[model samples]
Structure formats: C-alpha cells, structure tokens
Target: MTNATQAQLSRTAEFIAGAKATVPLIIGAIPFGIIFGTLAEPSGLSTAGALAMSLFVFAGSSQFIALGLLSAGAALPVIIATTFVVNLRHMLYAANLVPKVRHLPQKWRALMAFGLTDETFAAVSNRYLLQENIQNAHWFYLGSFLAMYGNWVLCTALGVGLGELFPDMTEWGLDFAMSVTFIGMVIPHLKSKPMWGAVIVAGAMAIATVTMPHKLGLIVAAVCGIAVGLSLQLLLKAQAASEAQSR
Candidate 1:
C-alpha cells in the first residue's frame, strides 16, 4: 500500500475515536430534549416552532432560555442577548480547537464552528488537543454532532406530540433536570477553592437577580461567576508570590 493510503486510514481511525467519545454526552441530551418538547406548548411555541428550534439553534441551554423568555413575553432583543450571552462559551471552545483545526480549510472550519456545541466541543476539543495522529478529526466531530442532532430532533418530536398527555411535570420535579444537568457539568470544573467560591457567588447573584426581565438573571450569574473566578485566581497567584518574596 502507498504511504498516502496508510495515512488516510490512520486519520479516519482518529476521527472515529473522537466521535465515539461523545456517546455519554448524547445520552445526557435525551431527557432534556423531551423536556424542551414538553415545555414548548406551555411556552406558546407551536410544535413546528419547537421542532425548528431543535433543528436550527440546537443548543439546549439557549433553547430553554429562549422558551422562558418567550413565555414571559420578552422582546426579541432580550431573547437574542440572553442567547448570545449563554452561548459566549462557544468562543472559548472554538479557541481551544484552533491549534488542532487551524490547518483545515476555512470552509471546513466554518462548518465545524456551526457544529461546535457544548458536548461536541468538550469531547472533540479534549481529544484533538490531547490525542495524536488525528487524521479524521472532522469525522469524529461529525459523528458526535449527528448523534446529538438526531437525539434532539426525535426527542423534541416526542415531547411536542405527547406534551398534552403529561401536564405539569414541574410538580413531578422533572423541571429540575436541566438544573441538575448544568450542576453536573459545572461541578467538574470546581477543582479549587476559588472555583468553589466563584460558583457560590454566582449562584447568589443569579437568585438575587431572578426578578430581572427576560431571564437576565442567568446572564448575571454567568458574569458574576466569571468575575469571581478570575478575581480569586489572580488573588491566589498574588498571595503565592508574596509568600515566596517574604521567605
């Protein structure tokens, strides 16, 4: 076999490896998609609109925020701003992929950028950054993205179609699934005292600002978390420096 053929096979294997790593993330999306479908009716969005959201936006958190604001009769601006803020994390995700993806064509980069959701971003970024001989990184992302996209669409259809069958899931505590999912995601990052402190401060700010219009409370929480996290991280660094100088 030619060297080029061998290299192509190797890249394809790497891509598949990246894709398989996204299974857990896809599993986690099912219940949330169901909830979104169930909530779409209550949020005043038609089944069609709800399904369209899953197809187009595809971001679970942003979709939930959009629904909450729509239910609250928020203007388009507020909904758009909140969605942007919630998804700003994508910028960081994209940056992490830069070292691995920078060599790809600009068009491929754009397509990958569109597919870069939280779960895929986490899985693909970790693999590409850490793994070697990643010939088919794009295929791995495609696998993860397609898996998630399918789950979102099917579950949403189920939710919207059966939404009326099960009313008031809030009383059943099902509404907390989203919060639980987020907590699960966030807890892993709180490996330091300052990280914990930032989470607490952000939680407090979010609750305190809950009355804000158009679900701005979430934005407040995110900002507070970033500010506190960065601030405490800097303080710890400075303290370490001071102690070294004193010694």
Candidate 2:
C-alpha cells in the first residue's frame, strides 16, 4: 500500500480502538440517557427541546438538573447558573488533556473540546497515560467522542418514544447503572494517595451537601475533591524535591 493509504488505515484503526475502549462506559450511560428522555417531557420539556439539549448541551447531569428546574418553574438565569456550576468539572478535565493536545490546530482542538464528555475524557486520558501510538491518538479520542455522543442521542430518542408509550417509565430507577459505571471507572484510577484523599473528601462533601438546592452538592463535592487532590500532589512533589536536594 502507498504511504497515504497506510496512514489513513492507521487513523481508522486508532479511532476504532478508542470507540472499543469506551464501550463499557457507553453501556452504563444508556439507561441514564433514556431516563433523561423519559423525564424530559414530564418535566415540561418538549420532545424537540429534549433532543436539542442532548444534541447541543450533551451533559447528562446538567440536563437532568435543568429538566427538574424547568418543571419547578425556575427562571432561565437559575437554570443556566445551576447547570454551569455542575459542569465546571469539565474545566479540570480539559486542563488535564491540554498538554497532550496543545500541538494540534485550533479547529481540531475545538472539535475535541466540544465532544469532551466524561466517558470520552476517561477513555482518552487512559490512552494518553499509556503513551501508546501518540501520533494517531487524536483519532482514538474522536472515536470515543463520537461513540458516546451517538449513543446518548440514540438512547434519548428511544426514551422519548418509550415515554410516549409509558408515561411513568422514569419511576423504574434504571439510572443506577450510570452510578455503578462511574464507580467502576474511578476505582481503578485510585492507585495513589492523592486520588484516595480526593475521593474520600469528595464523598464526604457530597453527602454533607446532599440536601442543597439545585444539586449544588455535586459542584461542592467536585471542588473539594479537586482541591484535596491538587494539594496532596503538590505536597508530594515538594517532599520529593526536598529529599533530592538533601541527597
């Protein structure tokens, strides 16, 4: 094969690998997406609006919170602010991946940024951590992003259809699958003291603030967890530096 053809094949293979890596997370998110769809109309969102949120916003937790607020007759500003706070965790995700993608062009960076969901981030970060096939890694990121984005949209549409047939479908509590999936993703990564510290602090904060309005507890937990993680990391680095200097 020619060089160009071989390069094309390599990109395709990387993309497929990325998508395959995200399959477990996608399975977990399916019921969550469906639940969002089932609850959307009952929570005062039109079918089009529901689909638009999945298409455009593409943030499951924020969408669910926004739906609840809409049903409660919340103001537009309130919905926007609440969801914005809930999604601030994405900033950290972006920060973690910025070093790896900084050399890419603006267009590529923008597209990747738009498609950066939790599942995609987890899959991409793990791939980057392994430092495997660095040249075509972006293709892998794209594959994971598209797989998750497509799956979410399809599941949402399915939920919308199911909602029409069974108006009470949201009451079945199928959303727990997502919680299990998140736990599975996070547990494997807690291989260090900083990670364990962050999880512990975040869990405590989440429980303590569970009764807060508009699900603000989630934001609080995320902030606390990030702070704890960063502090521990810095401290460890400083200790290592001091030890090296003494030696």
> Considering every candidate listed, which one attains the maximal TM-score?
2
- Give me the candidate number with maximum lDDT: 2
Question: Per-residue lDDT of 56-166 in model 2, one digit per residue for the tens?
Answer: 999998999899899999999999999988888899899888988888999999999989888899888878866855788999999999999999999999999999999
Question: Runs in model 1 with CA error above 4 Å?
Answer: 2-8, 132-135, 183-247
Error of 1 at 208 (Å): 6.5
* Clash pairs (backbone) in predicted model 2: none
Q: Which whole-number lDDT from 0 to 100 does residue 17 have in model 1? A: 70
* Tens digits of lDDT, candidate 1, 1-247: 9999997887677666766776676667777888889999999999899999999888888999899999999999989988897787677677668888788888988878878887787667556776786656777887777777788899899888778898765356555655555566666667797889888998999889989965667667777887888899999999999999999
lDDT of 2 at 64: 91
Enumerate clash totals for all models, in the order shown.
Answer: 2, 0
> For model 2, where is the 10-residue window of minimal lDDT?
126-135
In model 1, which range of ten residues has the least summed lDDT? 169-178
Candidate 2 deviant stretches above 4 angstroms: 238-247
